[model samples]
Target: MTSRSAPDRLLSVLAAFDHAHPALTLTDISRRAGLTLTTAHRLVGELARWGALERDASGTYHVGLRLWELAALAPRGPALRQVALPYLEDLYEATHENVQLAVRDGGEVVYTEWLSGRSSVGVHIRVGARWPLHATGVGLALLAHGDPGFQEEYCAGPLASFTPYTITEPELLRRTLAEVRRSGVAVSDRQVTPDALSVAAPVRGPDGTVTAAVSVVVPHSGARVPALTPALRLAARGISRALGWHPPTPVPAEDT
Candidate 1:
């Protein structure tokens, strides 16, 4: 067997913790990281000293605040969230619905910010939660604006289904994406959950490429899709403008 490098071994110990396993014992880290107890102990000590991991009173370790501090510096992650937050807050105030901002990562959409409204539908999404591109309104907006080749490849995938309403067929998903592009909005009708629906619009960058998506989730039973579309699109455009995107100016007409 090939030997793992020092950096790989160190990263493995840190990677042992995830959304599912947020804390771990020394033995658990050693097992999950495929390292010896002694090696795991050494690495964990270094990481703790560097503030990359923190140990609890029970001797279990969790990812530390230092990592979050570093992650905040990423332009596509927390930086984008900082720029989009005011617009998200405004949308939340206007609709009192669950407002979210997400960016596409591979075949999944990683939610960067979420504001829960007092009377919003029950959604289990956290800031870092991820969902497949075919299941959520934000995901559909992003997928619809993605590169043509990548979109084609994603539409041919083994799409995972969350609720009965989730689009599982490739052809149907393709059609839905087309409609999203034509209408400048995407609707996830009880797709993620049977009781919740979402309306989403694309957020573009200065280069006119889709960088993120914004959405509002409401109860599916009485969802006002048409009513929510304008607000969602307006908020998305505001965020895009904040990120240096401007709608193209029309060319002047020639002499008649």
Candidate 2:
């Protein structure tokens, strides 16, 4: 096998930890990163000393708080979360459901913020979690506003299905996107999980381009799509305006 660069090797050590393996011993890191024991030890020490990784009392390493501080500086990460948090809170207060803000990263949506109410339905989502664009309301909202060429290409093939309701056919997905555009909202009906339903709306930037999406998830058994849609759209627009988006002013009819 070709030797990895120093930077690549170091990054692999950190990448060894994920949602499933949030903490690992030095030997575990070595095996997961495909490096020798000595190399893993050296890289892990360097990262721990630099505050990018933290070693617990059990000798297992996890991502450090310092990395979180750096992540906060990402424009599409914490920076956007800081702007949309208030509106998200308001939406949660109004519906007492699970409120989420997500941004599209390629063909997937990365959830940036989530607000859960006491009575909210159980949803298996956390900050930084990713889901395909065809399986969630927030994902659908972002996909509908994405570039037409990219949307067409994404709809072409290889769409993953999480549940029976997930849109796997290209033509049906195309129609769904068109409906999202016309209705100004996207509804995900048990696409991700059979018991969950979501309603989402696009959040625009200063240039009036959709840069993110916001949604509310509730139990599908007693879902109220009509009752929830208005609140979700209002919260999304509130966040978009906070991000400097101005609704296009209607042009007056020209005198004949």
Candidate 3:
């Protein structure tokens, strides 16, 4: 059997922690990282000392602040969040709905920021939650603006269904992406959940490439897509502008 390299072994240990399993014991890490108890203990000790993991009084280890400090340096994660937070806050204040900022990573959208009021409809989204590209508004906006070849490949792959309304057909998903591109806004009605709807618009970088997405999720029963589209578009434009994107003249300013 070929042995794993040192970097691979270390990363495997870190990969054991996710949104679902934030804390773990030594045995859990050993099992999940596919390492023997001795190896896991050695690596865990190194990581904890280096501040990548922290152990509590109960001997359960959680991600440490040092990792967070490093994660902040990632341009798409905390850096994007810092630039988009004001616009997200504005959208949340205006609509009093759940607002989010996300960027595409592989076939999924990774949410970077989330804000919601105490009375807003509840959703299964958090700061780092991931969702499929065809099943959420932000995901649609990002996927629609993605490279055409990659988009086609993603559309042709298996589409997971969270609700009956999710776009499962490749042709239909292609059509939806086209519409999102044409309209500069993507509306997801009961796609992620039966009772929730989201309206999203793409946020662009300095070169006008779609870099991220901003959205507001509200209850599906009285969702006002027509009313929400304008505000959502404006917020997206504001974020794009802050990111150094100069909206083109022939195209509408809101499409940036």
Candidate 4:
């Protein structure tokens, strides 16, 4: 730790906090960050002073609001959410179910926004939550639209299985991606959990690249994919439009 660069050491402290471990005591931070107690203290104090972290009355440290302020500046985070919220809200209103918007980060999809009604189906999801690219609807949508070579590489790698229905076979996953591209939507049925179904559509940026995804999660028992597809696609399309995407015009057919 002492020999590492200053930026790496500081980032290590911040990286210790995550969705699973949002609060950490000084000792916990030291051990998790692989830093000495004195080094942890000095860095924590500096971070708290800079408003990157906060120390509570009990002395536990938490990610501070300043980080959120900075995260809002990310183009794929708050900027995308700001434009997608209304459409997400509309989708939520249509089904009164769980609506989500996410962007891909390497092999995972990071949720940027989520909307759930009081009676929405329970899902293992929250804002800032992450899941592998082959497990969830938004993940599959993003993965299918990603670079072709990367998609093939990802399929060749091992896939984590959360339920019996999760696609663990690489060939099946390849076929799934082809279907997603063909249909312009992705359905993840009982993949993440035994009783949740997710239908997702891709969102495009100004360059017509797949930049993000929108999804609606509902109970698998009575999931109506046909009913949900239109609304979900509408929300995705609205967000894409707001992001300045224009569908490509078809070329004129040539005479024989």
Candidate 5:
């Protein structure tokens, strides 16, 4: 929960409905949030009244527009997505592939926006989707730019593999992260899905810290990694600039 008061229990109920389980019955929410049915009912009622949750005709609750509006205020969420949308659109237009924007939320990457192109490969990724640190291109880009301690802990993981190409080894994952940092971009070839490939570049903030990532996913067999890097990097830089990152001032020349 964002806060740790009695209301946190209710907020936790709201938090539990993400991309994976966008719609849940009261019982489902109660079990998932580890709250008793009575507690769940009470909290859900409060949140529904507050416009944070909405009950559908079938009695299942989904996240309400109110919460989505609140999440929009988060600088790392919709704020960033808004600044990046045009560039994201350009990338999608150029490649005719799936484009996405994501941020590091703890050890996972949460996709905030996605644009699917007509000819793109079939990918299960959706808005609000979450993926582990080592599984997808955007996830790897965020993980590679994260704090060292967190990176170490994540690398020492029982890494989940979505496909045979997923890097499940700690040492190998470390090396790959190093490469991504050095090259300023990441690529996942059939790592998350057998028929898809993704290339991602880190989006920086005003202070030059990596704040988000942008990526494009295409069909694995016909993907052109070499040609796609420039487009991805251009979009990343555009988003960073929109977020107020100015080019570093070049040092003055010495006296002649």
Candidate 6:
């Protein structure tokens, strides 16, 4: 293992536990983070004392509520989620489908909120689940509006395939992103799950930058993408306006 500075090593131990590996013993954490068991124990003790991690009765540790509370302060995470939630609720009431809100985190999308659909299509995605930027509709919407360098790096595959329709080819993925930009929305039809489809639109910030995305997931069979598109777009635009986005003024034809 490469030698990391003490602070870096400690932070790595904390980073090792995410949505995938939420529960870990000291040994598991040490191995996953490439840290010595003693170092893991020391760092874990400190984190536990500070309430960043919680130790279970079985001696496993998971992220604590305190950490979740701290993450709430991040404007791009829970803060945005809180503001968009009412509109998300309205969309869910309208469609009775799975509603999700997510933001770009590195080359992946981190889900901040999820509302279960009554039909229950076997999608197990949770509040903190992450998926590649090229596969999920929310991820695509966020990535399409991201910085050029970040977008280029993300499009360089190692793209994961969840279903047959997932865009694993770089060229196809590139085309799909371009389309998202042009249409101001994204549709992932059975890309993440074979039976489910998702339609997503970008949520903008005060400065008009895409900060997050909202999506509705429904069964792919007999799906009406056209009908869902308008609802999703309206929800996204409502959230964007709530964040203070205003369209630029149009000049009158007489002025020309």
For 1-256, candidate 1 gives per-residue lDDT tens digits of 0388999999999999989999999999999999999999999999999999999999999999998799999998999999999999999999989999999999999999999986678888998999999999999999999999999999998999989999999999999999998888999998999999999999999998999999999999989998998898889989999999987667212100
How far is each candidate from the true structure, as Cα RMSD in Å?
3.3, 3.1, 1.7, 3.1, 4.6, 3.8
lDDT for 34 in candidate 1 is: 94
lDDT of 4 by residue, 50-73 (tens): 899999999999999898799899
Please report, in order, the local distance difference test score of every candidate based on alpha carbons. 0.93, 0.92, 0.93, 0.91, 0.87, 0.88
Cα deviation of 70, candidate 5, in Å:
1.9
Quote the lDDT for 2 in model 6: 55
Per-residue error at 79 for model 2, in Å?
0.6
Global CA lDDT of candidate 1, please?
0.93
Higher lDDT: candidate 3 or 6?
A: 3
Q: Which candidate, 5 or 6, would have the higher lDDT against the true structure?
A: 6
List pairs with backbone clashes in candidate 5: none
TM-scores of the models, in the order given: 0.95, 0.95, 0.95, 0.94, 0.85, 0.85
Model 4 global lDDT (CA atoms, 0 to 1):
0.91
Model 1 TM-score (2 dp): 0.95
lDDT of 6 by residue, 147-218 (tens): 988888888878999999999988888899999887778999889889998999998888988989999988
Runs in model 1 lying further than 4 Å from the true structure: 251-256
Query: What is the alpha-carbon lDDT for the whole of candidate 3?
Result: 0.93
lDDT of 5: 0.87
Q: After TM-score superposition, what is the CA distance of residue 67 in candidate 2 from its true location, in Å? A: 0.9
Give one digit per residue, the lDDT tens place, for model 3 in 2-116: 3899999999999999988999999999999999999999999999999999999999999999999999999999999999898888898899889999999999999988997
What does the lDDT read for residue 237 in candidate 2? 82
